[model samples]
Target: MNTSVVDCQKRLCPLRYLPRQPLSDPQASSQSASCVATSACESSALSFKRQAVRRSITPEFAKKVQSRSQVPVSRRSMRLQAIRPLRSLLHSKTTVSSALRPWGARGFASALVDKQVEGERITKVAELASEQAVRVTFEDGATAKFHKLWLRDHCRCEHCMHPETQQRQLDTASIPMDTPLHRLEVTDAGDAVAIDWDAPVRGTPCTASEFDAQWLRDHAYALEGGNAEDEDTAPYPKSYRQPRLTTQQLWAGADFQLPTHDYNKCVDNIEPLMRDLYTYGLVRVSDTPNSMEATEKFSKKIGFVLRTIYGTMWTTNPTNDAEGYNDTASTNLELLHHTDGTYIRDPPGLQIFNCAAQAGEGGESRYVDSFHVVETLRKENPEAFRVLSTTPLPYFTVDNDAHLATMEPLIRVDYAGNVVQFRHNDYDRAPLTHLSFEEVGEFYKVHRKLLEVLRRPETEFCMRLQVGDMMIVDNQRVMHGRHAFQGGDRALIGCYIGRTEYESRLRVLGII
Candidate 1:
């Protein structure tokens, strides 16, 4: 047999399925079964190749091969004829061992099997190195050191985080600065990192809890100092910036039309609604059902309805009460521009109002972008702006059912000196008991100026909301009011939602 023919047979046969033989021994050729199998495989492979070449090659190539070939066609044909019996024996329906079957017939290839086994191996482990920190090692030989204080502060155990709400319960200040990790180990499956803390009482051992491996991976920070220049490259997402609007820019359109969507679309697909709320600070949904239940459902679609003294969902209509303690919203009187819940320390972040019945005349809704007003005040009168932003004002509401009092600056600025929240309500404001005589005079000066700017015709937009129209406003960024109506029945249902839940929905929808 030619050397090339033997080499081709070796390549064609599955190496694992072939019987072991010594390649150095020339006597190996005397093995009849192996020799027969090799010769049959070679003949079959050559036949398949010849058929492919005949179909694919041009006639000119066939002529060139016929003229240049040293071996006669008759000899080649004779060898093919001799291998016919062996080919028939190999192809016959006979029992074969599982090990002799081709690769992938019984299972995956060897390389793929190795890869899966490696992937299932343990990839993460944690060990207690000292009283100060725990060392975590990953599969790739990379390691991270987590401080004891950091680990205790971020523990997600039920005692640390509320099981139902997932809110943190542990107080950072209560945790000892010298808290020590007594024991640390990786779970057997390597899906979690378990840690045991040394309690003050030696007999009472702290319960062991597991931290998710992926969570640890996500929060891993480098122990070494990184480039200082990279810290201030871009602002974080939570950092506040002034709203992208001016009085002139917002009123440039023929009408101040906010982003509007159908009520059904707003409920079913909330991404666009969230985007609009983040951008314009207000959104309107048309054709809502005329009921308080519909308003509750609309608020729940984005976040839970915030229950206050007024209830989860409150109805506002003209009430003929002679009581002096009644809220301005309960009467059929024109309301000045104001945000709700200014008397609460943490006021509702979003407010929704749905018109269930239209007034016969003169109940136009008015809205002013507090962000734009703040920008104007900041530019025109920097001193007044500074006073409003820094000085806390008294806002209180006292009735038979509830007595709420809070002191917050009319304009709130974050650490970056960007305006974050605006809370103002002339009707609900209490006496300035905490400020001095000079401070009170300066505060009133700025307070009056802010209200003047808020009520300006160009600064506020007015619209008559028809029945079945709902408007959603960012209570922190926009102030709303209503015109007094006469000789008609007007009804509106309103609700509040927390800012954290609203922003969580936006994150889940990838709107922010």
Candidate 2:
């Protein structure tokens, strides 16, 4: 390690002085690295290499330093002698350096051999030639590998990604399977890295991409070599993904509490409402203005109204005629606990139902926590749970206007082995011809077991929503049904909110 050349005194940035792994930036054209050559600490031994690295400091890193410190890089200091760092955002303590990934314009920092190291970050970046990827090592001895093609495909530069729309401009199909990287280094204060895509047989030439360290960590699929025993079995890898916000608080009849909200106050502040809805899978709002307008207003708080064949804002007013909407809910029939829209991919996240008019008797709402049922099944009947979780069932709805269909497992788990979604609807479950005869028998047995769980008295939360009450249900996590009705004009105003927009609202509100 060097003893004295590094100087981070005051009113200057020492970002360019630390040791590097022999790489230079082609972006910095205006500045010269010789500004500190006249300083007493300059050594003739490494003079040529030192100046070359300093001159290549990216402007983006300097801007970040200035913005973070809230200190203007004064004009008087740019032309002066020794360069020292004004520690504010970055660690302002004794440090050392290395050539990890491309630091924004930063040189790596280190602690003495005896003292414990702090602010540990990427300390080394190397190409894993055999793996066709690049590997980054953190100071704590952790390594993550990113395939070269994946890196090239995710370039977010202006040329690769559209600025306003934030969509990819490059064609993914044209990229080589094992993309070559002519250059790749950590950049942006070691927060991100720059990549230069080597000339390929299929894709664009000399493409450059910069990826954030955190992004790399989040999307890292494997280390230098993956473990065969620890192979991922989750259908979806959590690469920058966490499907559910919190562990589902599964409930039976005795343990459940139907969360209630004030419709008026929820309009002003929906955080508490959102918290309850996501935590318990459903929430009831008291004092709702029993009108379609009010229902639409309340539904928008969750997300835009999801348009379907049943219309954007639909009203379920049971009719005597058999030929009504394609849905069973359209008629006054005793509906069993089941999930809605199982026929559609990316089903609605939340379902809103406001009692605009209450029936005289019957038509009581029934809800069962699907997540809880699946968990119980997993514990009591492991084989049945496995069969249900692994088997795909088809659901379809054909109407005069539209035909919708989808095939998905009853229980879906993430790569982390956490249950992420539940899709169960026996009423909509079309046919079972796709499965083998033995598999079909198993599916039937497990499905019956699931029905038994659903039929348990402790599982269903029965309620008769009063006029002016609004109920918001987490469609993916809860199965909803209603008791048959015969008397009075019952009207329920409701709409579906797409899961995409529902999750987006949570993110924008910082609830997730």
Candidate 3:
């Protein structure tokens, strides 16, 4: 090779620039020098092609580049001209350019190559065995097992899955119980796990499909006898194990306080507010602006204000609203422990009440976790719990134009029998149906028992909200009420927020 060619290759392969070892063996130096020359020639060729495809330097771009580098375009152009002959020499055989590339360029090239190599490795099967169930160990040391039924139902080929939606089309029920696997093999490059069926099962013919290595790894289950931490299982609820604090536990000392945050902090960083809500099912934000607009803005931080017959946001005080045939929330009477909007199908997930003005003596706010009460009732009085959980009660709201009503059990349970919500509004209780005379009588007895449980001294947590203090409660779990006030200026601005929206914000913040 020419002397210049060797230097060019050295420039490309900077790794060879490291100090050479003692040449006790002369052959090592020759071998190293030959390698450097070959690498430099290859890198030059690749760099030439890259430069050719790059956009032609406009005057503006050139000026910007020159300003940043403090270099003239002519000097840069002359350097490119010097490499043109070398580029032409190596272009026809493109292999040399990559080998001769500089460290940075080589690193980038290797990254792409690494990705392809990794994909190939993932599909390589390390082991395959089937006794009662089919198991596979991947080349990366990860292992997985699949039930025959599970594998048949999860086929992802175009024939088994809808190409557009990527949803499985296989009928789970139609899969035969005696389905047998003929053979299982790792595909070339280790991209997938391919399975072959021995014969037709049910009406479907023997078929084969490739399961992506990544997909298998994700869905794989840990071995049954493995350590608990190694098991792949759905995580427990974020709010699970939260203390079911009693009224005494909550207000234990004079310095006792609700989980509180500043209004601005609540808006700017929602994690604290969400954390409070998840733990206590309620949070108090202080120093909020004493205006209905501020309440609306605060509610909007969680989600949009939920509009109802009273509109998106409303004000309630002794002087402004009428104490006629309407909701008790609008009146100044001592209200009972209950959740709001039981009459609506989808009750507000969250409720916000900003105390714009303080009252004279009595109007203290009260809260109780109905979920806690339900758990107690379930444990103490199983019969009463059954009645409340099974009997559907009617809740209705009759306003000037609205006659909304809905029927649901007092205690709502999810599919897994976990308590999800509680609906109890004595003032809004409508006529009961879908029950016999004896059942109706029993329901009333259970209902009274439930109310007694909620009204327990240990269950009620009270606080007198001051001006600029706002309370945010989870309507699903926490029931709130208020005491009667006599002679002071007591005003509250309030709004509702949907639970879905509140959760969406938490998800966006990655709090849940």
Model 1, range 166-269, lDDT digits (tens) per residue?
A: 34566767667887666677777675578787653222222444565534543455322223223222122211211122222233112567789898766545
How many Å off is the CA of 244 in candidate 3? Answer: 18
Candidate 1 residue pairs in backbone clash? none
Q: Give the number of the best model, judged by lDDT.
A: 2
Model 3 C-alpha RMSD vs. true structure (Å) is 17.5
The residue ranges of model 2 lying beyond 4 angstroms of the native Cα positions read 1-120, 162-164, 171-211, 223-239, 242-247, 320-323, 398-408, 413-418, 431-436
Candidate 2's displacement at residue 214, Å, is 3.5
lDDT of 3 by residue, 1-512 (tens): 32333233323322221112223334554455445445644554334334211211123322332234322323222222222223222232333322222212221112111111133235334323344456656564555667766777666554464322324456667766767677678766565677776544443443765665544554565433223245334333211211122121222212335788998766545556776786668889989999987788667767778989888887777654553426666667998888999999989999999998877778999888888888888988989998898788889988857899999888988655777788889889997777899998898898888878777787788999999999999898889999997777788899999977775544333334
Residue by residue across 1-512, what tens digits does model 2's lDDT show? 11122222211223332111121331231132223322322233244233222322233432332233322222112312111221111222212211111222121121011011233346668898898878887545667877777777766454554322334567778887877777777763665577677653233332666665554654567654323234333345544243243444788865688989888778756767877877888899999998888889778766789998777998888652354676677778898888888999877888999998877879999999998898898889999888888898999988867888999998987755578788888788898879998998888898899889878998889999898888999999999999998788888889999987776555433344
Clashes of each: 0, 12, 8
* lDDT at position 357, candidate 3: 84
Please give the range of 10 consecutive residues that has the lowest summed lDDT in model 1. 108-117
TM-score of 1: 0.56
Q: Give each model a TM-score.
A: 0.56, 0.68, 0.61
**True lDDT of residue 293, candidate 2:** 87
* lDDT of every predicted structure (CA atoms): 0.61, 0.63, 0.61
Query: Order of candidates by TM-score, top first?
Result: 2, 3, 1
Per-residue error at 277 for model 2, in Å?
1.9
